[model samples]
Target chain A: MSQHARGQRPEAAPFTERTPRVVAARHLTRRQGRDKAGRFLVEGAQAVREALAWQGGQVHELFVTETAAERNPELLQEASNAGIRISEVTDKAADSLSETVTPQGLIAVCDAVPQPLDTALQGTPRLVAVLYGVSDPGNAGTVTRVADAAGADAVIFASDTVDPHNGKCVRASTGSLFHLPIARSRDAAEVFAACRTAGLRLVAADGYAKQDLVEASAKGELKQPTAWVFGSEAHGLPDDVVASLDTSLKVPLYGAAESLNLATAAAVCLYASARDQRS
Target chain B: MSQHARGQRPEAAPFTERTPRVVAARHLTRRQGRDKAGRFLVEGAQAVREALAWQGGQVHELFVTETAAERNPELLQEASNAGIRISEVTDKAADSLSETVTPQGLIAVCDAVPQPLDTALQGTPRLVAVLYGVSDPGNAGTVTRVADAAGADAVIFASDTVDPHNGKCVRASTGSLFHLPIARSRDAAEVFAACRTAGLRLVAADGYAKQDLVEASAKGELKQPTAWVFGSEAHGLPDDVVASLDTSLKVPLYGAAESLNLATAAAVCLYASARDQRS
Candidate 1:
């Protein structure tokens, strides 16, 4: 590649929305396209930065508008130095590649980063979050972020959960998607088998469970290696799934709310384990 | 009111989008309209049910699509028994009043239920969540829901935060809005002052704070009447706001995540206090 093409170029007409590569990147917006192409789009400066910085993730290309390039020269410089393709695109082109109402004008096309379940759970995992039937992109991603924050070993998207590589989920993860080990599986039993094989106890965060978070912690249950299973807030863990888990514990509700949002419950449960294990 | 209009009208021509009442209810989709009308829209079966159930709240009217009315006869019957205005609307009319892509076909016009700061914090309180400059409707509402679940005494939307009555906020709260006390304030100073006067310590949930939740709880600091203040995750508590609080504590990031989402952070802090105080 020419030196001029490798880094920030001098003022020139950027590629338009019609650019062939831009058109290809836009296809990553859909799940099937992402699956077939083995890539997904990451938007906004923070997420793009994480993509570039992630050792486990590969950011194949970077697209930035002139204004975004000006505002984030360091990011562009990093992308350029990493031998990634950096395409300077027009504002319209950036908009085409974005999913948010307010496009940040910085988008990165990265490899779909989730690994196979066995690979993600390979180590002696101390804490994990396994999601089942969580189809909301935002909720799935928020739970991933909380899992990362609580220092869980990995996050498993299992059994009909939204694809973590989906745009909204990636945005809601706030770059945590690139910071942790993520895996997906069509089989719930396999996910449980992998976690158990990794020496992690399975605990379902069920709202109706007689055992509460406080009691679980007090009983030294959270001190062990554990995988906290969660279902969508709209529908709690299926009875059969709960029956398969070693135990189920609810986050104690002190107020009148009948239930907690899925992500909130995950945060409370995962952090309780983090604290107990560390203490 | 005529008996025919009191409850679910059997197969009658449903109200169209242009109907006068539907037009007025549609206005509640915007913030200014809600402020001017002193009412807001609650959509979907879950929220509408809570609006009808709230003793402290007034459900001014109920709008239901024909299918929604059929699916939720008990909800409509309850509204009728309470003398609430129940208007069946066309599917198109229901869509016009909804913010979500898939309209739930149930809507309730309810009085804006936030009380004054002084009134909301009137009694002695063990836990509270105060949001300052939290502009995202989802985040604001999610915090409210978690606060309620943690048994927080109240939620205070202070200084540039999104109105809790926002349609998206109400939907995110998932009926928790009607379950607890909520207050709004233009003045952050007054919010802190009120909590202090009510014998509550002011704790800011600052990501950059020197003290973390586990350390705070270990020190027995969380076992007291406290109001945990939070700011937007994008731009954490302003420096001045953090300084004014009695103490600031961070939720420890056990993993590579730089910080927790606002609601996630609040959940960890509030639940810690709940456990500590209860223990």
Candidate 2:
């Protein structure tokens, strides 16, 4: 409501199944278009609402169904105030734009907002999560949301990690993808070098490690400025990567489970650091 | 090596795309057939291996492609020594039985082994993870694996929770579904009664809770016999359901993320109890 004095806004465009704009928005379904256009699409009410709340100006346009618009006119009105183009699209169009079997009927076309890894590492970071060789978009996205929830300064994806702009990744992140600065490094070595240059201690989340995560934090191991490297779910951290870190810590598995899934393990490690630093 | 003393097995039947037995196994793909036959299909090499190791004779049949059997003849040979039926299936048949987009070329039909809630609660349980209204099979399964990793004595799925025998759930459990005793309850009241009778304290993992999970465990709050309740991703524990619990705990959030995901939150809570009890 701060800058909404732009007064009365024009009505939304008529519902259309296909238009030049709709065609362009649909093109965001691919990585090539996303990179070329420097834009990505976020679907559903929660994500669109979060975009308006945080990155209002960056939201280029919003597409909604009649039902969605009627149910949440506030969302459209807010976007209109921020100069975001608003339009209505057919349910079929919404379904075509969605990855899920059932589409949520609201999509926000927004400018890509990923921060450069160098920029995110320039200042002292109290906590950071580096994803190395994480190929699953869902896992990568959840980790991004978790890093934000755990109060990490940023989430850095090594060159090999899945694109955070992937629709599935955006969906999995819920709304938190926009809440934090997502950074990217050329590789793990670059991540290590940057963390070292920024005075952040590097710690790897290794399931095979003897050091217990909670115990290590309790013993002041995670009290320093930290960067937690989470590896691929299948192979874990590379041997050289783990050896180069300050120390690798594991969440203790007391029963028959081989290890916690990647996202959960990341949550435990990041929260441990959050608690250790906050305490 | 230990089991081959049973001697040379009969020659395997010729690979086929469809047969009476294959049809029956395919029917097991649905819940009605599974309940009727008291069996479910476990696919992929990892799941089948774990099924053999944990459930042993319960694995009724081994269906594999020639490639799978040739690549891992020892697996089929072990099944043979165990007196389990070993049938080679055509690659197309294997594909037909698989639920995943890219089938891993192995499937095992196994007996259901869930224990009753009362039976699981008969003995003193050091830790438990309860799914009160969890609807997603994937989340339920991961929580089961997480609980097992945290050394919970058992995992209880209340009425209306997704079936633990569901194929996706089984896959997500990574065979921890067999590693721990899985119990089914009549409802929330039955779960509460059973937990009370067992002298187990109840804790619900709520994203909205004010009580911090890490702090609570650090204070010896989780040291006593505990049962942690996890709810659905869409609708968390019912208000009445949560009100009946001893307390609800949340993982502290230091940043802008609204909350931790269902699986990750469950993992953090269960692992907290695990660490506390061990200490």
Candidate 3:
């Protein structure tokens, strides 16, 4: 380590290593990387800020561009003061490291994983969102944000869905990613079983369901501790998942358009249940 | 123009006079390109396919990479049979012409716009959506698609809103851009005037509105000839817009999350109104 490296000005090369260890850490690619490390990269200034605000000490490292640090000095200072490692990278390096364009030049490595299904059901969770096979990272992120806004107790991402830790998903969550508990499982049947054990009612949202969402959410009609299952737009909920549910609900369509986008449908259902629970 | 000059393969020259003309023709930077000329660009194959299925004759030109044409000969034949001008470009050219990564090697120049508001209001339109200051092209597009599915008679894009003809918006609409009538106007005042003239009730959707959506719709309180207004998530409907409405409705939220995304809220309200109308 050199004095020049430690006391160098903003534009000057600072760390002694030339390459910070955190910045040089191996990139995670497979599910094993996520499961083994218990950490994933959350990119963008807004998302990283939300993670810091919500999870605080849970963040392992912060990588930021010089421009981002200059733009948000307080954030950089906070990270440094909290004993979190910080590294400055070139714009090109940040771009290469980021998953989306216009990355906002900051990224955080943070700890997050699927919580146990029982933990989500422990409370009187009248509203829950179950996402099945939603592979688009942005849509998944939006659903998480929507679920949080609607005050759902938790969100369950079922099999074959995009990793919720993906950078795009974090950005699309608009900061809600940090505020909600999320559980991921390969088998939705297990989720149903947990709901059954917890004395929760399960409702599946289908385009052809006989009951309208309003009717399904009427007082005393929707069993308390409810879990609402939403499926991908291209394919409705898996037949088995649908069959396992106690009731099915639909948002009636007035026009000939095939269906609402998956996130929009989930928002509708989540808000409906939220309304019912509140009133 | 001589056949040699007109038919010179796009590949033979690095820059062709026709190339700029074609690119300019497909660009929507000018209002005349979308209005007087009644043409807008649809980038990517999935979007082009949706446009073709919904408004085939409205497509004036088809641009494709050789690879894309080889893979989708049926699409090529459909364009050719419809007398749409076809031009082949290199993958680089396609990339340059597209806004999305992985351009899908195809784009279409089409002619279409929102249907007249009056015509769309026929047959007792129970639900309508108004978008104010929603500058995000993708959000505007998703709203259009949702309005189509919810069977809303028309969508009004008020002041400061993004152009519905933006390529991303068109692509997001997934062909519903052609199915629904969307009107772009100066502000809420004009929208209010239009609604009043048409004998429709105006219901503005606000986060703090007193009435809950389900209650408003379930009671047949906001039934027939209704217009539902949604504002940007950043700056909600202007004070004037909120004050002049017949009623203001909110989607009840049960959590600490700030608010629902603009498009998501609109979809819920529209679907609620659709359900009310159906019953």
Candidate 4:
């Protein structure tokens, strides 16, 4: 074992608000900087812990405040043992690296967490979520978390969806972002075709669809491999997109609600498929 | 019928930002003001419309800007026909009444929405949602919407649960607030007892439950009338609260997610009851 204790003492000089590296990390809050740098910032202890545990994730650096360092000593020790550069920072510097009102005082610079669609769907994907035009970062991240909970194989973000690396999305995901494979594409049609070729039936969660979850379940359509496609909450899947799918089914609204939230609908559809497929 | 023309002409002088009535209406945004006045503000067109439609709701006043009036002439006419007071207000006055960044140019003051717990759980209720200490307005409201969508008979806001009349909660409910019965109480045990007396079984969605949804389903537990009790997402049902419930079952997590969001889990649980009961 190495003689020097890891994460035993804070860095001799903690990073200040004016630190250039900390300043650079702040830009990851925006999409342009994240895309160009091929990296993003993961804030809060839970997400940072997930990033550190994910074998495929490259957590290059960790920024922590004195209070946070004490609060999460085990996580810091883990990061130190993994050879990740641990930088001590002042509260102001921690604030600079966070987008939330109350920063959890921990952040990690990670490689973008997405891979190619083909790579994500390589094997037989029994349950997958394809978010098309899901622009809300919170909804997108919530869906990612829901998909993971449903035992989904992968989540494909296609065509104008919010960047999965967005801070709000990551926070809303509550560490589920790092738990599963994520893939992105600009061409939604190609993504749908790829899903079909992978032997997963495309089922869009359309609000206006004639068939509901019960009917789909009755027909035994939900038991098969399915890639559940969801669109924006404001606008359901585009007519052209819905037309191209194998079929579309609506989450039944038994009461007076006109429609379900995008994440809510996705949870219902994905869990339905999960229940039937597992049964 | 003798009126010159309904909603055809704007008031001679629209209420200014400093108008006393407009100033008074803004106070409804706060809990203290809302509680003191026994009234709350419902913003946006959809909610205002729902308030207009609800037989139980008394839409006391309607505030509208010129632009919104022009856009929704029919809604104004409907309000006019309903004998509700229509107050034309300046854009500045409308802005003063809204909490959202983009005001929908419509706001309605209505009576507080909660009723007695016994009244909410009245009748042979097949399904219901009991939110205990769910303080997040968004989560509580979304659960209310989900409960409505699943055709639950009522939603009981138990104990320290957020006031369902909170502006964010009302907006998040997307007008479902007016579609169903809502009950509130400071005593959670009373709420549980009332639910049990109503012939509804209490099922808590616990993350650490040894019994999963599959086992619960296989045991024919879900087929009966049930009141699904959910707690806050951050801290689940308190130990004492969970211990008092009939039984607790967790949504089976097929993937790596630690837990589902409160609303997501509620949707899955409520819809499961809907499925079995309907079948």
Candidate 5:
């Protein structure tokens, strides 16, 4: 790390898509490289700021196009203060690094924030969102965001679920992905075991369940430290999986609409618990 | 209408991209075409069934891959009984007709189900969801589905909002588009005028509002014939729009989430009013 005067780090030559950092960032788009390298790409200013804010300086390098450097002096200032390595990248290179249709001209390579299921269970989690075989990256991200907003203790994504650091999930999370601990279990059995050992009640967010969310919450059932399990939007929890859970809660639908989607259902279920717990 | 024997409609020629109906279905991929033709493409078996079941016979034609025809003989028999023109398409042609990554092998050409604001207002409205400048087609569709599930009378989309028939919205609606009345207003002002004329209360789903959804439901404020107005996920109802509404309701966040996305917020808000009105 070279020490330079404030606002005086000499601009390095712009790198193309072939440059090591840009190549690395693009490769992080795939799970293989991400797992091997133990890092993923964080795009946009807000996500970058949050990634940098994560304890222990996870962001190793920042890539900025010349236009972004000129337009976003503040982000550069933040990077400088955080002692992050900054490099100038070609416009085309920045475009390649971003997964969005419109590149933000900035991207950061940050360490993947994955915790072992046991690690997440160490602290008695009051409220947790367990995603089992939830394949959609967007739903996975939104649920993480909702769980974070509801001030849940953690989110556990089963190994069969979409990668938590997938670009689409990160984008939908809108920086909330960095706000909480994320755990991955190899299977639903691992998650079930974890919650049991942690002494947390397991409640399934089932559309077909007999108990209504509001009714259950009003009766003081939701105030307990609980782990709320959700599955793919198309399918609720599997029969075997549900049988293992302590209880199943359904958000009562008053209209002709059949059921709420995965992300929305999780929001309602978690927020009910959140409100009840807070009150 | 062709008077064909039961299950005996002559197999029409395979439609190339240039063929009239295929071109029309493909044209529906654009907003202009959907408006000009006054029809849209409804894909998948579930959506096709819903469109056919819609009153006044909105579905005019059905296209099927040979595989789907063999696998879903009952759907074809039902289509024939309903007097729908069914055509067999090549796998490539079926692929062309679908916008999804995996073509569902069934597509129905149905009339765009937009009702006049007056028409929506004419009915004794109990519940409705209005989307203003919501550009995301998926969100628009999901909200419409949620509104329908909550048994809302109608779903309204402001002119600037994404077309309800847009491929993404239709896909996300999970066929709910055919299950209810959809009204499009030239602007939010027009929506306001319609609601006032219909003597319905307007409640904006605002994040910053002081009122909590549960409290409002408990007090019976949500039981009135109401129109729930939502805006783009990026921004809530505009200040001027909020000033015109009867009141605003916020789904209380006990979690750390700053606010819910457009789809999730509409679900919680609509259901709160729905539960109150019903119970």
Candidate 6:
């Protein structure tokens, strides 16, 4: 046995898996992970740390390269302190485990379903962001970060969007994913129904909408418990979702470019509502 | 000599040693050929199409692989129609010329500093996006696309920002860069001063700010000719700039996330102003 294997305490057993079956099970493609394991990979030191801090129980295992463990002894210490398992592997193993070219040498396998929507929506629950077919993981992650920063009640990803568990998305959120409530719904209508039951008004963001977001917010049209819906740049929101919304709001483009990126549109809409509720 | 060379028609130029040198000069990284010659590179069928559409007189030579010419006959015809010189290169040569992993196998060499900014910003420009020290080329490109969609008068890159002509940025913009007026300023203060003189309000975006964006814009605070200033996510707008701005606005953070991505923040700010102006 290696020195690490011999020195490994009982707490590390859950995390240190050398069997090919266990190792293979841990590696999941975005689609397979989302469907089968209901888990996603979160990489980078800061992101993994955030997950450890905020959602410790949800993290399945902690993977760290020997070099990374040497560099960040505190992380290992924290895992041990939290009663979380730790696995140390070679840099090559870590690289294969990572999504990005330059992995931060740390990664976490976490539950994909996240926490329950009700738990996330608890409290006053004044503001929320509803993502409709946001196809890019980075954009989706950014929306989560913005939602967390804006103190949104929750961020719901509707069906047909990119897998939120994609590595790029986790890094883009800058560790905000740990603190943010993200629920995945296969049906947009069902997600909307939940928001409606929660007493949230749906505000759809569309470039061609006649009502400007500022105007709509100022008129108290979006003042109630609200869910801001942002769509992909390629295809705006699905027709049915747009039709079912309480109001369609536009950001008001003055240039020749046709549309703003999906995440940017969401931030603008969410911030508008945040401003209205605060005042 | 080939038929193309023999014809001396506007359509063709036989492949020669000079052709590679001409096509290579357009990129900033290529120290040899045109980049060394202070030229710039334009790549891909779409970018090349836009270059043709713009009637960009700076185009020196065009490089096309046999496959590219076969696949995009219209692109070659368009170049030929414009009386531009065209050369057929080997697949290996085309691969070497491409910046992306999958080269479209088409590229153009054009004079650097295609068109001066003073000429582009001739009229009373109403909106502008000022990027300060945003180092990511992809972010810069996305910002440009958002600015264009917002109908901003121009997009300015402050010192230390990534080069606008980067291949990744150009691709990310989805050809919006061709339509947008992108200017570079070594001194941010000078750019801000110019905008101020031009009667544009300087709205600096920072995570920590006294006023919310909606309130600021609704109060006609950022309605007029305006320059939206965004900085890198790591270090936000410089203190000096923020202090000097007409107003500093923040997107309220309701969640625990510290900040939104730079491009997202800029889009939110720009769109807020767009909403106010439209209403």
Please identify model 6 stretches exceeding 4 Å from their true place.
A1-25, A28-39, A55-57, A113-126, A207-220, A238-249, B1-39, B55-62, B65-80, B86-91, B111-123, B201-203, B210-215, B238-248, B277-279
Q: Write candidate 5's Cα lDDT for B1-279 as tens digits.
A: 122322444645566667777876888778898899998898888888878778833788888877777777778888988878988777888888888999988898888888888886676888888898899999999898888878888889985898888888998888778778788976778888898788789988899888977788768898898999898988777898888889988887665557778887787788777767876
1 versus 3: better lDDT goes to: 1
Worst 10 residues of 5 chain A by lDDT: A1-10
Model 5 Cα displacement at A42 (Å)? 0.6
Q: Would you estimate the TM-scores of all the predictions? A: 0.92, 0.92, 0.81, 0.95, 0.91, 0.83
Q: Which numbered prediction scores highest in DockQ against the true structure?
A: 4
Cα lDDT for residue B9, candidate 1: 59
CAPRI-style grade of the A/B interface in model 3: medium
> What is the number of residue pairs that collide in model 6?
16
**Candidate 5 lDDT, A1-279, residue by residue in tens:** 122322535755678999876887788889898888988999988888788778733888988877777767777888888888888888899988788998888899998887777877777788999998898999999999888878888899974889988999999887777878888876788788898899889998888899988788768999999999999977778988888899999988766667878987887788778777876
Q: Write the per-residue lDDT of candidate 1 for residues A191-252, one digit (tens) a residue.
A: 99999999999999999899898998989999999999999878889999999999999999
Better of 2 and 5 by TM-score: 2
Question: Candidate 1: where are CA atoms >4 Å away?
Answer: A1-20, B1-27, B90-96
Give lDDT tens digits, candidate 4, residues B1-279: 113322444457888889999999988989999989989998887888899889776989988887788778778888888888888788899998888889988888899898888888889999999999999999999999999999999999999999999978998899888888999898998999999999999998899888987778877899899999999988999888888999999999999999999999999999988988898
- Note the Cα lDDT for every prediction shown: 0.89, 0.82, 0.73, 0.89, 0.82, 0.73
TM-score of 1: 0.92
Please give the distance, in angstroms, between residue B45's alpha carbon in candidate 6 and its true position after superposition. Answer: 3.8
For model 1 the local lDDT of residue B78 reads 89
Model 4 lDDT per residue over A1-279, tens place: 011322454447788978898988888878999999999999988899899888766999998887888788788889888888888888999998888999988999999989888888998888999999999999999999999999999999999999999899999898888888899999998898889889999998999899998899988999999999999988878999999999999999999999889888888999999999988
